[model samples]
Target chain A: MTRARLGLGLLGLTAAALAAGCQDVGGTVALGVRDEAVYAREVHAVLEARCGTLDCHGDARRPLRIYAETGLRLRDELRGQPLTAEELGDNLRAIEAIDPGAAAEDHLLVRKPLAVAAGGQRHLGGELWATRTAAAPTCLVAFLGGRDDAAMADACAAARAEVSLPPP
Target chain B: MSRRTLAQVATLALAALLAAGCLGETPEEQAARALGPDTCGGGRRRGEDDDEGGPEHRCGQPCLFCHSASYNPGEKIFIMAGTVFTRPGDTVGVGGAEVALEDAAGHQVSVLTNSTGNFMLSRGSSLQQRGKGQVRVPFDLVYPVSVVVRKDGVERKMRSHIQREASCAVCHAAALSATSAGHVVLEGP
Candidate 1:
């Protein structure tokens, strides 16, 4: 009877180990899948909505350039630049929200604003004022008021819907 | 006598005649003879009979006059005229405020206020001889007998006093107390 009890205990341990391994595998698969189309759409929408209008982020005269043309190239520009932890966290949250499973989150929404943060009020006002444009509908004021979560989530859904990659 | 002696006698006689002519005239008579008639005229030369020129005085229309404190030369003390808002549905009519420069001896220099509630007090060209120093200027509100407003109705007679630039040290300090005050030291050193 003691030998039977030992066999049952070993089976239970093996089952628990298999369950933990399955969870790890699932997390890895979720992170590894690359949806390039979704990434591109998200990048485009963020640029259009936040950085494309004149006299705001779109104006080249501003110290920080948030125009759509340059904004799309943010990933390469911001690659090893040092950022404050608060800034890094804001960027990480934005990236994670847009690309849920992607390992490399390269987006202008995080990098451009972080770069312009040093210009203080003028740059902040310009970026906030640019949101009045119809094409780029998101305003920094709404984002500041905690209303950006739904807007960003909708943008993410729209991007995912446009993605054409087949299921693995 | 020799010919030279005879010539000297003739020169002495001429000198004596000239001396007699000079002694016969009075000082005023000589002066009258020197200066021609009509010396004082509407457009005559000096010392003439009709000479009208005396001393030049400031004659043009007076421009707006403003004055600053002597000690704190930058602070402009002016009477501010505006309707004062009283508490609880009352608007007081302030016709003008009396702004003055107070000396240590209890002397008050009164300044006039214009229609726009602006008054200027400065040393005139003749009064510039007084040394520059701070003067205390106090403002007194001139309340009208009755203040009538279309909506707010009438207000009671109210009197209030406001004091500004009372002490010399208020403006004489190294740093300026208010940004609106003009530069203490005038330009062109």
Candidate 2:
């Protein structure tokens, strides 16, 4: 074969190999489907406030590190810098990776912070949702359940409002 | 385990020395080890009410780093804390400055910086804790505090509300980065 033909043949083989490996580990995340916009608006802020501190999940040493403008950032980025789209994408992947095949109630992300009394596993971070009615937890529940754009947005607004108001 | 970074190694060494020094201490001695009264940031000891000395024991470090329940153990806990600097990238503290906080419940309270420019909002053991030129509400602070720092009539307000006030430097690092807005500064970066 000519040199150009040989190079094309090798490139085609590599592409085929990569494509073959891209199978669904979990049925939730479809191939090439990451609902970043919905997550950015509804879920990202919740994560940043709850888990994005450098002393917490935001630490670079964590396996599921959360990057945000408030605490942890991508390498070479200043703290005051904005959370870029790529960072949101990175956060989504990290969050989804915690048992992607599981349902929202069964997912590690939900089970970790959930209260022990609520049947959740032990989490050294303590119980974030003592009763599971808190805004952040419910917001995550909505998003991870199905990331329905409208439902997630409503849940997000409720969560933000709860954060704004003082305890009655 | 992987090699410890310089920061980690230095922290471990300091912790070891501190632990060794406190190994034989009594309960009362342990309680007195924390540097200040419940809320005032001016590095005063347990009985001290006046800002007579320089900055608190350690200047420029985040107040809550060692003031929380996790770190101080038997010592008092500081729910919100941080240091104010003279300028960005500068370690010189802005003494006598004011850190004003407006919580979500419309509770407006402010505190003056100690000689070392450290300010912490703590729930004192008693309601008698006080600071010069500032007033603190007796109730717990509502979250999402709006912060403004003023010195010499020149005020610099933080553009963002203090979302997570567990420690100012928790999100505000000594070095500016995408994660930290740097230390609370009176001036430039």
Candidate 3:
């Protein structure tokens, strides 16, 4: 009986070890994992959802088109090369500050305001900004999550303000 | 076990521990460490009022606009131009596009695409170069033009392939688009 109990205990330990090994460390926070390929995807999604829409950055009518597919086609129309550490850091800081705890940063909530205040044209819509404050952490958080929402009211408002658009 | 065997087991255990440590922390942890923790408490608060102007103008609204460009002191300004083609009568707005210029060192200068499918960056500016003017720049810079177009209520985004002036010349050498004024056209399908 003693030997059997010891064997059983050893088996349990092995099982526990195996389970621990199978557990995922990256889980949800995996979004923050900054692989070049993954970074490309994350940045692309964030730019598209937050920056690309309406006549802001989304409108082909605008100059300096920054669209979803910008990552693949960055060699043609712009000078220099891919994003640098500093630029990415700047973008991340802008987005992260507004919607802390989100996987991706919402540039609309934070960056847009700073840009507009600094005399930069607003690339986001006005509606987005108006509703942004109300939506609270979710809108900001979602932006940081790099998730796309069909109705980005807050972002729209903030963007509109950045461009000095009239109130709706 | 013998002394040699004991030492070998210890070494093996140390190697395993090292491997486990490496596998323990993920890229996100590293990025968070690099970026720092979030102290903002993951909630929205209203403080400042965002008052810019009246409602945003729709497509075809005439307005004066400026393209973003950088003027680095020690580099020539490489202007990238492109075109966005649309239906003859359809009024579509261009905005929320990603524009970028990258150097060989992965240093990128970027600006959002505006409502006219135009983005520009003036590298080697006097301000960037501490009041230096006209410096020799390399052609190694890559210019990327991309934009999102919104018609009615739907949004469509497009990005051009990474091609330099030299590469573009391989096809449109004779009818090459002008670099001045950052003119690049996007023809819709």
What tens digits encode model 2's per-residue C-alpha lDDT throughout B22-95? 78866534544544443334334334444233335345555565567666632546767777888876554667
TM-score of 3: 0.23
Residue-wise C-alpha lDDT for candidate 1, range A35-142, written one tens digit per residue: 333334344345433443222433334433432321212333432233233332333344344434432212234323332443322334333222222222232222
Could you give me the TM-score of model 2 versus the true structure?
0.60
- Predicted complex 2: CAPRI docking category: incorrect
Question: What would the C-alpha RMSD of candidate 1 be, to one decimal place?
Answer: 36.6
Q: Score each candidate by Cα lDDT.
A: 0.31, 0.67, 0.36
* Docking band of candidate 3: incorrect
Better of 2 and 3 by lDDT: 2
Q: DockQ, in order, for the candidates?
A: 0.01, 0.21, 0.03
lDDT of 3 by residue, B67-151 (tens): 1133222132334432222333233324444434443345554444445433333444231311111122233353232334443
Report the number of the highest-lDDT candidate: 2
- lDDT by residue for model 2 over A71-102, one digit each (tens)? 67786555556789888898888887756667
Model 3, range A88-116, lDDT digits (tens) per residue? 44344433443345433333344342344
In candidate 1, stretches whose alpha carbon ends up further than 4 angstroms from where it belongs are: A1-36, A61-123, A126-168, B1-189
lDDT of 3 at A97: 40
